[model samples]
Target: MHEQNPALGLVHVLRAVTVEFDLLGAEFAARHGLHPTDVRALIHLLDATRAGTRATPGWLGEQLRLHSAGTTALIDRLERLGLVRRSRDTADRRRVLLEVEEKATELGWAFFGPVIGEVLAAAEGFEAAELETVRRFLTSVLESVGRARSA
Candidate 1:
């Protein structure tokens, strides 16, 4: 009998997690009358705001692997739904920033709050060191995947 490669096992686990996450995202999108891609773009915009950074349509395009026209259409759709708005950057007048609407934030938290609380509660079971290890591992995985995609 041959032993399975640990790396291969980890890859399988990660793949399963990715699939589950995608399914969850799809469900969330459907509940909000959005496509999965739009939900993901909105999440990215929200995260950027949380990090004190503004997200531009071009940046969102790159993040979502969308072209300029597609990104514009997405922004238009979200803007029409009142989930996001486009504002000119104060410092860079030529730059248009995507801002998630307050109502959208409220809706997101209302919909995802329970799961967020559960995930936070689960994290409390881990020690600080274990959490740090997990964070580092996930970051490394993200880097590796980014490199692979670019390559």
Candidate 2:
């Protein structure tokens, strides 16, 4: 099989890699008493917004492949744990923004640290060129999969 169509043969390998990541994510969510989608939502929020930057439900929904109303509900749950808060955008009177509520990140790190560290360590030996290749491929997959989900 490889002798005939080797170039695209890696698609199956990529799918397997994606499945492993999903399994790890599911385990993390279950251990933390969260839905996998909720944890995924948290990741997207953390990625796009820093300590002081504002993140909105609309923005998060777009990024996380969730509906605006669903993002609001997930946020409501996170808010109960004092994870986040909704804010009115000062410059745009009618807009709402979500900002990291401080304690949430600290708490997340506590439960998530070991697993994340292990995953990072597993990839630590890759050369810079290899790492760059992996990053480029993975980012391309992320965008394609994300676009597919939203579509």
Candidate 3:
């Protein structure tokens, strides 16, 4: 199929990539003895840490589309695994914050480093303009998926 053929080429590429990611996620979860949802919650917490932000059970529940009870249970499981810790916010004693443990953070980086390196290396083959276009395309795809989910 021609690269310019959105229906045949782009759509197939998108679908394939999505499936590949899903499979990869499942594998990662299995390796860590976690459920897929737990892996996702960990990823969200990791992302928040990288962004210099803290995640709360309430916020994580909303993000994961899980109820409060479910979120609390997930958090409890993670804590038992030594992957995460819950603490009271110093600024707000009533607020509880979830933080990824250092060992768990290291484990994630070690497991995902090769894949991340390969992705970066692949992007290095593209010119700045091409990379920018790819970024924009991915952003649009993400927005579209979010809209579809909400609908």
Candidate 4:
């Protein structure tokens, strides 16, 4: 309880959430015949697209902490699966960019749409101010994790 150690309780909850996500990710990987690293790469590409950021293989390599050969191999695997494609940047024809294919998005939504819906349904229980507080808390937690990763 908060009376004893609030931080420990929050950490436990976060850990539980992480475990659940990892399990779900594993299931998705198995069903799709993808390695965990492949799933992570897809997620990074999707996030970058959503953020309106151009995602290059080099950037993805950094995000995945992979060497060029590993990154190329991963990309090749995804491309062979038709889940990803390489495109030349129009602004700089020499630069290659990674793009998630529609099939990948459709597959991802097919698997995770219900989970997303449930999350939104649960969020509906909170008032605006309460949701704001939750957002702030989550943002701080993300920042802490980012700092720890860099350190």
Candidate 5:
């Protein structure tokens, strides 16, 4: 099928990604004691550090594509484990920020090193231009789909 045949091409690519990504998530979760749901939450928190922005539960819920209740529960478990905390935003009493603790932050960073190393090794031959193109494309795709309710 050609790329112009969007439905068939997209379906094939999407299925392949879904299978591989699911396995990656399962393996990471197994090795980390983080369920698939919690792994996504951790990923959300980990990625949010790029902008030095603290996400509220609402923000994280949106980021993780979780409903309010689910986000609340996820945070609840995380907070209980001392991984994440709900802190009132000093600038606004009404704003509650979800903060990943220092220990969780350190541990989470270490946890993802292997995944990054593997991907880097796999991309070793890609030209800088090609790498940038892939980065932009993936970033755009992620931004478009990050809050999606379903795959």
Candidate 6:
């Protein structure tokens, strides 16, 4: 249903997409016996890795809005599950950095691989210029949401 205000329609569509992803995350969390925050932390860790940034406890705490004790506890749990490991930064022997384990990647791929493939197939139908416009729009939305979160 197209609305007179295209922006409002876009907002509704985005919200629907967000809800579906949230539900998928919830399912994954339940299946793996993990907390919602754990899934969120893993996602952030993955994103940091993709961005070529070292993920430290302090940085993760800031990203997750968690305090030291909470972050430590989360790390400990993930560590026990074999999903993450803490390694001392080679360049800075005293600093610790978080890393996602192979097990975590395997588990994530097993669960999300099909969905990612479906998304890719859908994206393949879009022309390059149309996809670029969609990418720019989503990037702007992400930036705006980040600003709102910190405000």
Among all candidates shown, the one with the greatest TM-score: 6
Each candidate: RMSD: 1.6, 3.1, 2.0, 1.5, 3.8, 1.3
User: How high is the lDDT of residue 9 in model 6?
Assistant: 83
lDDT rank order = 6, 4, 1, 3, 5, 2
The global C-alpha lDDT for each of the candidates, from Candidate 1 onward, is 0.91, 0.78, 0.90, 0.96, 0.80, 0.97
**Which residue pairs come into collision in candidate 4?**
none
lDDT of 3 by residue, 115-134 (tens): 88999999999999999998
Tens digits of per-residue lDDT for model 2, 9-122: 677778887798788778867876778877787777787675545678887887676787888889998788677788899999799887766776886788668878986997
Instruction: Give the alpha carbon lDDT tens digit for every residue of 1-151 in model 4.
Output: 2375887889999999999999999999999999999999999999999999899999999999999999999999999999999999999999999999999999999999999999999999999999999899989999999899889
Give me candidate 3's TM-score against the actual structure. 0.91
Model 6, 1-151: lDDT tens digits are 5447889889889999999999999999999999999999999999999999999999999999999999999999999999999999999999999999999999999999999999999999999999999999999999999999999
TM-score on alpha carbons, each prediction: 0.91, 0.74, 0.91, 0.96, 0.73, 0.97
Task: List pairs with backbone clashes in candidate 1.
Answer: none
Looking at model 6, the pairs that clash are none
> What TM-score would candidate 2 get against the native?
0.74
Q: What is candidate 1's CA lDDT for residue 29?
A: 89
lDDT, residue 23, model 4? 93
Off by over 4 Å in 3: 1-4
| Winner by lDDT between candidate 6 and candidate 1 | 6
Error of 4 at 39 (Å): 0.8
* Whole-structure CA lDDT of model 3: 0.90
Name the regions of candidate 2 deviating beyond 4 angstroms: 1-9, 50-54
Q: Count of backbone clashes for each model?
A: 0, 1, 0, 0, 0, 0
